[model samples]
Target: MARVETLKRQFFKCLGLLAGCTSFALWASQPQVVEKADKTELEWGNVLFEYYQKDYFEALIEYEYAKTINNDTAKSDYGQMLQGGMLLSYGQAKQSQEIFDRVLARSADPLVRNRAWYYLANLYYHKSEPEKAHQSLAKISGPVPSDLFPEFYHLTSLINSDVENLAQAENILSQVPEDSKHYPYVLFNVAIGQLRSNELKKSLINLTKVNQYAARSEEHASLSDRATHGLAQLALKSGNLPTAWANLQKIRTNGLYSNRGLLTYAWTAIKIKQFNEAIPALEILQSRDIAIPEVQEAKVLLAHLYEQQGAPRKALKSNLISIDEFAKGINRVAEARDIIAKQNVPEEFVRNLDVIIDDSDWFGAQPSIDYQKLTPFLIDLMSSRILNETLKELSDLYAIKKNLENWEFQSNEHLLIMNNADKKSISKEERKAIQRSKAIQQQLSDKKQELKLLMLSLKPEEQKRFQSTIDSIDKEIAILQSRTDGMSRLSQPYKQPASVKKEMKDKHNQVKQKLKQTSRLIAKLEPVVRSLVNEELDKHEERMRYYWAQSRLAKARLYDTTLMELDNVTSNKESGEGVK
Candidate 1:
């Protein structure tokens, strides 16, 4: 019995040893688990995610923590943040380039390298180096980040086009999916290329697609009009005048292509001998403040039509009216110049001339006069010592009023938010909730870390058991984060002080006094400008009358010559009768 018992114990020991060895072998065969990202790396990723979502304020906060980490991922994301101007000014783009270059050269991760290359390409594009941008883009061989794919394809197409590789550009554009936000732009460019290549049918097809897509989006209304204009041009080229006219009529009157379409419509009407139909379109074009290049042609056409209708005097009068209108504009420019020459403007006003011009509502109201045509006048005014000074004072006064209004608006908004928070007693409850949520979040994060560590020691089967628990914890953490997010934002420190309101009030009063003084000075100067303008207008009127009188004199001479010829013909016929 004792020998049997000994055999049983030995058998059990052998079985235990065999099981232990099996376990060791299985562990040895398993691949070594790579360590998951630590807290700082995770935070860096979160910052990048927020930035991707365009939540700039929240991203900025996370960036502050991530920027201190020594990891390559953190550095790469920080560089992107800088490039995006989340925490840095746009002036720091050069610095951002340097950081991206460092990451591209040093990072081991393929995704990081590709991302850095993409950013470098963008910077190069902005710097107007399309060749370098193209080269950087070509370095991206692997799968691109999903969010950047559309921009990637769009930019590649653009660079190809810039390099005059139209075929390549078209090929790249073709790869853009139909559902992509860039699809309309891509299709439009492709259509233009096709049109240039004389592939009219294909171009028309692409243009129709663009029109259909644009019609669904309010933001693309101008694009829709342009596509319609393209269709009109194509129809006209194909000698389908009625089809062309129908397409032209579809363009909205307020659209960007309206002027071109209207001009074409008038020209088409004339081609079809619909004189009356052409007249209204020409009149509208002529009356527009910004002189379209086609206006002169339209005026000549109108004059010819008027003569064809046996209204020579009306044609002459129309020509005179057009000339007078042009002369009046020139006179206004001259008046502005004279005002600058005579005024003794103060330095304060001179310094703020640009701001004054930018903020002035007067220019916006004068839509009849093309602002470009007034460039010389504005330049002279700004360069003039006295006029610039006066203009600057007006600008400063406008700016002061705007600033006061903005301050009051911001103060009211802040007060409303504060009052609501206080009334709801949300401040304290929010603090407590945030603290509790954060505490819970930390506990869950620690558990995740613990699980990750345990997984390294566990067999494959053992590791699977903890995954469900980790996933549950992750969901809980996500919920807690969502609930506390508002509180977290609310707890952020307010940078503006209550005392700013008082300061704004004081500034407002000071600006009011200055505005009154400036207005009075401007009043004193305006009459001088008005007198010069009247003098110039009188000169223009006299010149116009002289031209009109000359035209009438020439007409009278021609008419007298025709009467004399008729009398001579009658005398010839009487002499022939007498000879017979």
Candidate 2:
């Protein structure tokens, strides 16, 4: 009981550390807003308010609007940095990189520069470019803002991890105050770093301490099961069967690790000739609620055990049952895969798919597609890590794509309103505003090229790292070129005031540009999502085919055994010594 208590605490501590790394990554630490006021000041306040409320989309909109109207160029650099981070969170990594570069190139503020450098380093870290990311981090002038410290340290640790600098990673992790909520997790991280470095003895010692220092719950018990399971496997490898058995017993019976545990437990029992325990365990596992490869393998082993115990008939019956089950499973999976291949994954399904992040199985549940169509097929794939991850990525991409579409729709509506506005009473100020819109449109064209050139110049490593960004920009540019080549009105009848007509033209151009950008973004992400879905389906089909082959082989072996048994029975009768 005490051991279980300790296990839960240690595991939960590690889990919380992971949650911190994710949920506290970038904008989660932004300072909350206390007041809202009106133009730049007002928009900025709303940005902060929306951010604090976790309404990141609204916050980004307010920030972009604030940028358009704000007069303070110095402060704009800082605000753009924040906007860049929000874009990164929205999976707009390439756009975020552009913002970071612009801030670094134009801003002289140390604090702003530091924040910008930090984000740039973070972007590099995500790209798996350690040296480049490290170079970016080195450009920071002083301590990062206090609000950014946690995420900053996390990124540093990631860099250190990539470089195999375990000493620095451990040292940084060790700085967590003992009283802080992150303290246990920091200790957990140090142990993990040691484990990753293959300092197994040290890691086990630290893990032991972690378990001793904290209390626990069943909620995060799977992590404990995983650690214990590893220890069992290590013991078995070293010929310490007793130690392996004991360690395997510690795993929870209904946790994420339970399926593999039962399979391991039964195998270990069979190896030790503990038939009483092994048989019942395998029997219990033969139930169809779980269909992991481990469970299927255990069933095969169970039949072999029966054969070894002289129950040839029982073994044959068991193998036949499994062969039948596998046959149905293969056919059902094929039909399901065919159905999936015939239709695109529904956008709404991908958009609504819940993200599951279990360390044991990742997306560990059936996808959000119509289960009725693929019921039994999907059942066998519940614990697929690849499917989980692919589906989750698709969900996020679809969601971002939908957001871009909404923006595109809004721009179209805004353009229509501007195109049809009453022009009889236009003021001089409004005309200047129209001129400013035209100038900004020209600037947008210039900046689009600038952002692309920057994308092309990113650290060259198979071009895979920044390829998505470059492709997106190329697609957007191509879209613009196509539109430019297709149609234009060289002249227009001026029904409204001359200024009003000019304003209308400028507004029309701006709206068209915004619409193009949004449409291009949606276009860029949709194909990536569909390709991932297709890849996931292909991998699943491969697994099903492999399962079918294994079952066929097992069945063939069972048939051979039956023939041998019949020959033995005939030989015994001829000898007149076998009459049981």
Candidate 3:
């Protein structure tokens, strides 16, 4: 259930999956052990079992198998639809689309068709195609499963809100029971739609409802964090410093929005003239990984805050550190970019994706970087949203590639299982002797031929001079050829029967086809992944360069300030000395 929810969070931006997220959890929460489960039920049940356990690799493989059996069956439409939802969570958009579309076309059952339409509509909505979403939604007939009611209404409300049809959206939203698990997600999405329409008053009210709900419950900590942050931003815009500060305080220190919250928290304190509070917050932010843009800004803010507190030396010290740090970061991004540009290394991009698998608060304000491949310097470069989504795309591509590899392996393994195997081996001595002597024999033959050609143009004296060399070469070639001939004779023990050879050839071709399929996918995918990674590296370099320039300018201004102050003190001392 948690794994499904986590995947939903990752993909909800594009899939509009929040509506159906609770349904999976409900599925898991049920009593799943059946004493005499039907064979088909157990089969599809195992797929969901693996998925609920968060073993997505095996689950997807199982689902692929189920699809082969379940295709074109009305009874299997539900399982297919469920797997389509799972695929959507996994960011398998194209595959999910096919599954849903297939369910809609073939399944006469309203439950199955309606479920497909709702998923398709949600996918369209989250992708910002309201017209397409509405078209999909319009295909739905009267009755749906009780569990799908909230999702349908919530999804409809979201579309209406997106179109600025606030009254209709509100009516649809009211249809969803307030106690439903999906209500908060509904409120959050509608509020965002309101925000887009500049309906701040309505948006604020909805965000406040979400914020209040998040505060009271621990279920949706991330949504709570977002709501709290949104409320703070709204408060700040309205000059409600105290309210903004209060909301900022509500965000978890270790939460996804912590970095952004802290930054805003500091400025909110400053606005309310709480210098002591603001200073400590800024200091904490300055100590964080500068890969976050907020952290980068914090360094400058801290320096300026120190200057504001009438501490020029402290400000200058901070600016100097900023200059050095930005310079190092700029250089690191450049070096990493050059390496990526020169070499095609998929492992480098894959390293950035470890955080996605292990710690997937990818949509959070501070994305985690568990493996900083290339260099620690490129962490900031890979932290952008574009790169993050690209990483998801790579994740899907890798999953498909892995599935192909597993299929290829299984096909080869099956040939062995069927007892139709071909064993091709050579003795150690024979193999080594053949491999070693073959190259030397070729070189010796060429050398001997060259010598004969030279002898043809040379006098008898020249021929005599080269004869010993040619003799040495001839001896080497004779020895190598004898070793090669002996190894060949030993290796060519017996020929296979024609029937066995043909069977082995056919199986081998099957294996080869699988290999080709996997190789082709990798050959196509790696360049695209590398290109996106390279672009992020380039952006990181550009950002670091900008920060370095800013730091340098700040450093110069601080130095000038120090020099002017020192000169003033010196002049005052001279006047005092003259008067004395």
Q: Number of the top candidate by lDDT?
A: 3
Q: Write the per-residue lDDT of candidate 2 for residues 359-402, one digit (tens) a residue.
A: 23323455545434443334334445445544544554666556
Which residue runs of candidate 3 sit more than 4 Å off their true CA positions?
1-76, 79-99, 122-130, 141-143, 146-172, 177-179, 215-219, 271-274, 335-370, 373-390, 410-528, 534-540, 578-580
- Give the clashing residue pairs of candidate 1, or none: 289-368, 345-386, 349-389, 349-392, 349-393, 350-388, 350-389
Predicted candidate 1, C-alpha RMSD: 17.9
What are the C-alpha RMSDs, in order, of all predicted structures? Answer: 17.9, 23.6, 25.8
What overall lDDT, based on C-alpha atoms, would model 1 receive against the true structure?
A: 0.61
Task: Give each model's whole-structure lDDT.
Answer: 0.61, 0.62, 0.70
TM-score of each: 0.49, 0.65, 0.64
Q: What's model 3's lDDT at 97?
A: 94
**Candidate 3 structure quality by residue, lDDT tens digits, 1-580:** 4643443343333122222322322312324554544766777777878888977767877878877776332237777787788777677678899999887778899888888998899777756688888888778887866877887887887777666666666666676778877788888888887887899999999888886576546656778898889999998998888889999988887776788889999888888988778887788887876556677788888888888988988988998888887776666665666655544345444644565434455434342332343544445445555555555655665666666566666765665644433355566865665665565456546645654664666557756765675575555456546646665676454445768756765876775676677567657666765676666666666776777777778779888988998999999999999999
Deviation of model 2 at 173, angstroms: 1.8
Model 1, stretches more than 4 Å misplaced?
A: 1-73, 76-93, 108-110, 234-243, 291-301, 331-580
lDDT of 3 at 522: 58
| Native-structure RMSD, model 2 | 23.6
lDDT of 1 by residue, 91-116 (tens): 23566677777666667777767777
